[model samples]
Target: MSNIEIVDSNISTNSEKSCVFDSSINIDEISYNDFFSNYLIANKPCIIQSNATKNWPCKKDWIQNGAPNFTLLKQLFGDCTVPVADCNKRFYNSQDKDEMTINDYLNYWMDFRAQNYPTDSPLLYLKDWHCKKEHPKMSIYQVPKYFASDWLNEYYSGRTNLNDDYMFVYIGPKGSWTPFHADVFSSYSWSANIHGRKRWLIFPPGEENHLRDSFGKLNYDVLEDERIKNDNKSVKFYDIIQETGEIIFVPSGWHHQVWNLEDTISINHNWVNGCNINNMWLALKNELLSVMREIEDCKEMEDWSSHCQLMLKASHGMNYAQFYDFLSFIAEKRINSLVYKTPNLSFDTWIFGKNHNLFDLRQIKIILENFVEDAKDKSIYNLICKNDEVEMLLNKIELVFQSCK
Candidate 1:
């Protein structure tokens, strides 16, 4: 393991603070090789120190006097229309969100923080603003080496159909927070605090059993739940207080809830790579199953699978065809880098050449093979397998993998 360390805090009479989590690991200046081998491959979470974002302009330009620089931010991105969520209200399993100009949100923030404003107004949180896509001029930070091979963003760049990217900016007041949930697609995510502090309650895989009720419903709030505080056994979760400039790597499938200790702004990305692609696929299957169960009565219909696929696309963001497209796109890139002698090898894959390329190629091939075999009834398998483009890419990948041996 990559230097495991336990981090229990001083306990008071409060039962909530009684038992600490099993371990908390922090690394500074971790090399790409060490990061991949120790945390990525091991599917473990860790906090990397502030070296990654020390030089980011946001660290200075976006902060002033231990708070977010409202004037500077307005001068930079005031006119942009962005999505803001109502943190006090939940709708459709997430916070209610709408679009408004950045200036309007700033006005709300300023009013909310000033004296006794209308306290009944919901806490508006600026969530999931596509920082890179909307404002290409802002080069705040580079994708860290460990997280560069982001298939999601790479696949959807400038495409009309899949225009959305995973890179997001989150800004909220002191009481604003995200509810308990795993990342979308069960993807591994890294969050960097640029302005203020955040308190994170993270539950590792399988530990969520304690938080789930008998009916399989999860508790909305961890700190407020008596069951969580009372359960001294069968569950141990990390209580992390992330400070400004620190990065937290949340591994695939980990459930976490976050609270802003101060008025906070952060950059976060959800990524899928070779290490956690399997988990992503598994999460899709779970989503599909849930969708099917919801409309199980319609199973007798002839187009039931098609219905499931449509719902999957709407609910999970990608149907089988899109999933295949993502895999094929990534596979073709790897194959080309291996065959065409290009310097680009898909994000952080520059250092390790043919061996890593071949390994990733073989992994993609296996995932494709498994998906095809498993989804024989689906239209995507037939559409993808019979299509000349996908077939040619698969053949090229196979040839590359074979020649490497």
Candidate 2:
């Protein structure tokens, strides 16, 4: 990449003090009311001065042997450039193999690096290369459970149920150099750097113009490049270099760009609690709005009625599942037409084109309002609708037009 570096002393310190965490400083040590009120619920980012896997026996006893452990992890991780490995026939060997340690191995694979590992090596390119099955000894999702049992017991005392919408991402070196953008997913996230270091540049949401009408989606890469050139103007940015045993909480919709500074390992959990339910609902509403636009677009086409009739005939006597698949295909065509277009009309102008008059804003509003209300009340909507409301609405509108014909 991009050699843009923005450092924030608010999050970074050169203290040589080693932060140690054990059962004594578990989640119970911090009061839930205080923690949630002051930190977690507010979407404020904090460094939990504790080890994520302090209670795990494997992590405590794991040795940094250069052969079997390193060899096995390499086999599991595959080849990647940031980690710098060469293929020795079917197997791959790292140039830094001799310097492998527990910290180094953990750092190398934990950051987003594994995904960016050079694909040339057969050992790395296999689909199942990095796949790890859940086992009694090594349960992937159970890491949170272990933390709850050991550290978070006190803090989780009042919170009866924890939402499972969170994601656990382990990013390593060689991982994709993420562009500056906010997450479209409707949840806040907690990122813990278990090993190595990462540099982060963050900006508050809504501060930057998305420029989507020109580029379809937000052009984060271009935004990042521009931000770097104008850095002297004191634009909002934070550079975080988290070492082993630290956690950083990132709120939803905050624009952030992260790069692995070295062989790094970090786990991120994206979750939503009761307080953030409104944000999630708004995200859903945006999806519905997009769908309504597509439905309107499909209705404006000259052959719209005929196309819908043909599709309906194709789905005649088919099961609900088959009908849905066919409908999805129709929806995809409308969405694709919107996304990939000539330079003649911009996305916003194209969306408001004269051809979109057939469905009318009133009808589009009704469909969108109905979908959002239904989603909030019954929590039952088509999967395609949940994933992308615009496509589903377009397909459903086509079906309605076909019925009228």
Candidate 3:
């Protein structure tokens, strides 16, 4: 169990039993099995009430005074380096007046500090701030010793091991918001609010097509695009005003954007459990399928040049989708052994005559006979033989055999 003490200027302690207000929820009270099995592991986003920081001694203390003043924020993060745009514009206004865009401010702070701060200071340069898949920045002055305390360790016990997780602290003046995007790899996250309020809009995986262009690749600048805001009709957003001693759980593949209403201080923890690992595998499988389709398209040009040209003309030069479907049809008919095994000859070498003599009708007939026999045993030979292209090839082989005889 590790404990962290954050001093804030906006929040104040009222008495021994209360601090600032009783709006905070205790996250530790919720059963881990229920939360993980029902919500987190399901990749559903939810507000855990006061679940975060309940075990920490400093939770109430940190919330009482809000987050530390700008002086302290600067002292803790002044030397940290971050990315800047080509024009060097580091700040932007959010749609809501109450919140600040944290990424913009962090970029400015990082740019300024990197130019003037001493190299020996505890602060380090923030890498991958612009990368959607990369974790945010952390201050060496505030991590490790401060984070490894007993209270924090226990608070995160049910979640994951933080030492192996990617973590970052976000500090911003009022009105900071993160744009909408899903993480690169599947990542489960916990965010603790130390200062002000934050609003989040989240959508479940596969529930909505949050992506406008290609599904896997993402553009960070898209958040600023008006087209996205106007086109996003199915998204549901949540408002969480965490004063102090509060944390939020973010599930994997859930598209979310965060906004910091009022000067805010927060820390985010990212991790992956067993279920999330499976989600990552599924995402990778989809990427592999896309690559395989491309290979099949190249093969089609060599095997069916005239058909490929006719298909392209019919589709106005956009026949990849048709080609992909055709390849999938062929794959469905292929035997598992044939599909999984490496080809004896590369497609290029086979098409260009290097292996032409090796692929004579006799050899091809033998290979096809064995393949057809296996497919028949698997109940897929008819499906393969039914294909017009496959039937044409078979007819050509028959003609060659007749001539040879």
Work out the TM-score per prediction: 0.87, 0.48, 0.44
Looking at model 1, residue 116 earns an lDDT score of: 42
Worst 10 residues of 2 by lDDT: 1-10
lDDT, candidate 2, at 270: 48
- Count of residue pairs whose backbone atoms collide, per candidate: 0, 19, 31
The lDDT leader among the candidates is: 1
Model 2 residue 247 distance off true place after TM-score fit, in angstroms: 1.4
Better of 1 and 3 by TM-score: 1
What is the TM-score (0 to 1) of candidate 2? 0.48
Q: Ranking by lDDT, best first? A: 1, 3, 2
Better of 1 and 2 by lDDT: 1
| Per-residue accuracy of model 2 over 1-405 as CA lDDT, tens digit each | 111111210221122322221112255466433444444335444555555545533333221431123444454443332222212231211111122333444454443244556545322111111112212234332233212211111112222353122233343443334555565345566665555566666655554453343645554443335555566444554555555555665665666766656544455554543334345446655654444454555876775434443443343322223223433333333333334432212111222122222222223334445544554453334432447655556565556445434
**Which stretches of model 2 miss by more than 4 angstroms?**
1-29, 57-69, 72-166, 169-171, 174-176, 210-216, 229-234, 300-405
**Candidate 3 Cα errors over 4 Å, as ranges:** 1-25, 54-67, 73-77, 82-165, 210-243, 290-405
True-structure Cα RMSD, model 2? 18.5
Better of 1 and 3 by lDDT: 1
What's the C-alpha lDDT at position 232 in model 2? 43
Query: Poorest 10 consecutive residues of model 3 by lDDT?
Result: 346-355
Best by TM-score: 1
